[model samples]
Structures are given as C-alpha cells and as structure tokens.
Target: MARNPERRTALVDAAIEVLADEGARGLTFRAVDARAGVPVGTSSNYFANRDDLFMQAAARITVRMTPDPAKVEEAMRPTPSRELVADLMRWLVQRMEDDRTGYLAMLELRLEATRRPALRNRLTQPVRANFDESARFHQEAGLPGDADAFLVLYLAMTGLLLEHFTLPGVLIGPENDLQAEATLNRLVGTVVTRVIPPS
Candidate 1:
C-alpha cells in the first residue's frame, strides 16, 4: 500500500500536539495514532520508529516557534536598525509568551538530540542558519563583523526570552509592556557597546 502524505502530515501534527501537551517523555506511537485519529499501524507505517516521529515533530515545532525571516524583513524594512532590533526583541518575547508549550517541546527535543547523533545532524542546519542570519543582520546594521559577539548577543536575547517565559512573575512587573521595553533598550545598548568602538 502506498503511503498517504496527508496522513503522514496529520501524524506529525498529532505528534507535536502530544509532545506539547504531555511532554517528550509521554510521546508514543499509540498516543500519536490516537491523537491523529488513525489506526495503530498508521503511525508506525509512516514513522517506522520513535526517533523518526520525534525528529519530524521537533521540526514542526521549531518551525512554529520562530517567525518567517521574509515577513520579519518586510515588517522592519522601513524601520531604523535600532528600532528594528527592538521590534524583533519584542516579537521574540511575544513568541515565548504565546507558545510556551512549543518552546518546551523544542527544548526537550534539543536535550534528546544531545544523545542522538542523527537528530543532532538533522537540527544542525537550521540552528546554524538562525545564528548565521543573526550575524549577517548585525553586520548589515553596521555592527562589528565579529561572529563571537553576534553569537553572544543572540544567546543573551534568547536567554532573556526564555527566563521571562519560564519565570514570568519573577522578573517582569505588573506593567509587562513597560518592563519588556526597558529590557530591550538595555539589551540593545549592551550590544551596541560591544559591537561598536568609540568614535
């Protein structure tokens, strides 16, 4: 029997939902099949193994967690570089706040990839691409073309977003918008100091 692409996609989507709702430890072929409303053998036919299903689910979640670069570029096209960074920072915070489940699932997958070489290779390209884009954007914005500094800024921004989401009430005040704006301003100022030398 031929495989159904629609069913395969449905299974992958179901796997993502299962991971998000129940965490990576709760994922199973049976669970995915049930969530997908397909026969028990259906997920097995498509995925062949747990690792296969997990990689697909992780890819789907990763895609959902980040904004499309094209759309981001278009939205910031008319904005100044500093303003664009601030907007991107705001967007990152919003994504963290809106999709905590998806982010958690991604983190779970990342941890698993540490022990699974195949999964690590599968994720390496996308991870590298994200870092590369950050570096290129900083360079284009007249920052020093230091890859290390760009990576530090990227990691710092991501860390802040994660911390805010995982511990929302701790760092953020009653006025979250104001707090986020202040945080972004400070982050951008630090990046500027590191990326630019005194004139």
Candidate 2:
C-alpha cells in the first residue's frame, strides 16, 4: 500500500510535540493520534509498534533540534574562531533554554536505548550524525580534525547541558540566562582550548 507522505509527516511532527511535551513515558498511540488529529488506529498503521513510533519521533525531533548551519553561518559571518565558538555556545545555550522538555525527552530516549537493542540502533544514527557534524564544524573552523576529541567534547557538553536542565538548582546556584551562558562559556572555552591547539 502506498503511504501518504503528508499524513506521515504530520504524524511525525505530532509525535515530536508529544515526546517533547510529555517525554517517552507519555508517548502513546492514542496520544499521537489525538495530536495528529487522526484515528487511533492510524498511528498503528504508520508504525507497527511503540518502538517504531518512538524511533521516528526521535529522528524528527533530532532534526528539529539540531542547529541550523545556515543560521549559524549567518550569525557568525566574518567572525574568528574564538568568536564563532562563543556564538555557537550561545546558540546552544539558547536552544537548551527554549526546549527543556525536548532535552528531557532525549534523556529518556538515551536511557531507554540502553535496554532496548532496536532503540539503540535507531538512536545511534543521530548520535553518529551529531558527532560527524561537530567534527566537520571544527575542521571548518581550522581546528584539528580529531574525532576522539570532538566526541569527548560533544559528550561533555551534552552531559553538562542535560544535567543543567534536569537537575536544575542542584548543579547551578540560580537558573538564569547569565548563569547558564557563563557556565557554558567556561565549559566550552576549556573544551576548545584542550581540543584546539593555539596557532
């Protein structure tokens, strides 16, 4: 049977909204149907199981969450590496600021991937793509193309950001833009210095 691309796209978008708003624990076929404004069985028809639905939702959310290179480039036009890195960090902090729910959903998916082999594979694709993008971005910024270092920094930044979001006051004194940017700036500066050698 031919699939309806428009309907599939709508369902995926709805799934992202549900996952972002309610996390994986709250994701249900009926909920997705409600969000998509389709019959309950429609979700099942598009996705055979919850895992499949979650996988698609995660992929769509990842796409939506990732930084837009065009926007980054526009913002960083004629900027040097140091300034560019700062800009990138600021952008990341802004994203983390705007989407705490989505961040928590990603954390839930990460935890679930550990126990579910199928989910593991599905999640790994986005993980690898993120790392690849980071590596490419660093290389473009005239930094060494050290995949290991990129991976380490990526893991550290993501961990710190997720912790900041999830644990809130536990990790930082106050929850504010200045505090978040300061923490991210310090962490990003440290990682950049460690990974990118002085010219």
Candidate 3:
C-alpha cells in the first residue's frame, strides 16, 4: 500500500518483531508503531490491515529462516547422502535455537492460519510450494528416497523442533541427551535408512 520502500520495509520489519514478541493477538498497528519506535500510525500507513501485516511477516519469516543457498550447495554437492540430510537438519536445529523468537512467531502464525480461511489459503500455497521445491531439490540431486521422503522428514523434524525448543523438558527426558545435534542426526538418519527408499 505504501510506496515509500524504506518506510514500508521498516514497518514490515517492525511487524515481524511484534509478531515474534507479542504473538498475533498482540500485533496491532499501535503495538507495531511502538515496537518500531516510529510515529503512532506508521504501521497503519504501510499495511492495510492486521492480516496484511501477518502475510508480510510470514513472508519475511521464510526469508529470515531459510539457510543460505551457497552453504547448502556446498554441503549437498559432495553427496546427496543421508549424511547431507543430517547436516541440513543440524543446520535447521541450530537456526531454531539462534532465532528462537522468529521460529516461535512462525509457530504462532501457523496456528493463526488454521482459524482464518483467508489466511489459511494464503499460507497454504507457499507451504506447498516449499514442500514441492524441496522435493525437487532432493530428487534432482539424486538423493536417496523419493520426493515424499523429504516431506516426511520435514514433518518429523518439525515435530522434534517444536517440542524440543518450545516445550523443552517434554522431549528431553530420562534417556535423552542434551545435544540437539544428536537428536537431529538420529531423526534424519532414520528417515534416510529405514523410512525412505534407497534407490
């Protein structure tokens, strides 16, 4: 809505911060203005509504959370082996810890999508595209396992990440060790070995 790119970027970035710190319910134009330390109606000028802000924030999350492609290419080029997948999972887990608030807000955005039809539809397309793109990457790289395998790994690791980071002790109990890398190794290895096709 706003043509001023710098101001718009500032508002969107501020919206992301608000979403992360305050959750969706707490993300108001006023809240965003205060968080951005701008004028009282700065966010209102940039975004049409809260859902518009939500969409922009969600889009920003994808960009912020994705691993660097150069690093990924370097990592995966050596081999499309299970070890590569494990390394990727490790990267994801490390990112989750490093950007704790960002991932937490992502989870919040996901929940919000479920209740709102427009939001759900808006979010679902990108989610599917990400899945498809990952599948293609794994398949094209001649990785062990089919396209669906990556999808399953995504689901599995998502669950692990959610519980491990958000609920902490709920996942790390008696027999579990404190190292997330170990858990990611196990999860990725299992998917490649036992779950996904080797051919």
Number of the top lDDT candidate = 3
Q: What TM-score does candidate 1 get on C-alpha atoms? A: 0.76
Q: Per-residue lDDT for 39-134 in model 1, tens only?
A: 887788788689988888777776776787787777667534544555566666666658776776777677778888998887887878877876
TM per prediction? 0.76, 0.79, 0.86
Query: Which portions of model 3 miss their true places by more than 4 Å?
Result: 174-193, 196-199
lDDT of 3 by residue, 53-93 (tens): 88888887777777788877787766567666666677778
Evaluation by lDDT, superior candidate among 1 and 3: 3
Q: Which residue pairs clash within candidate 1?
A: none
70-188: candidate 2 lDDT, tens digit per residue:
88778657545654554576578778678665666777788878888988899898888877877787777665436676677677777768777777565566758787667766766
TM-score of 2: 0.79
Ranking by TM-score: 3, 2, 1
Q: Residue 120 in candidate 1 has what lDDT?
A: 86
- The per-residue C-alpha lDDT of model 1 at residue 43 equals 84
Each candidate's lDDT (Cα)? Answer: 0.71, 0.74, 0.76
Residue-pair clashes per prediction, in order, are 0, 0, 0
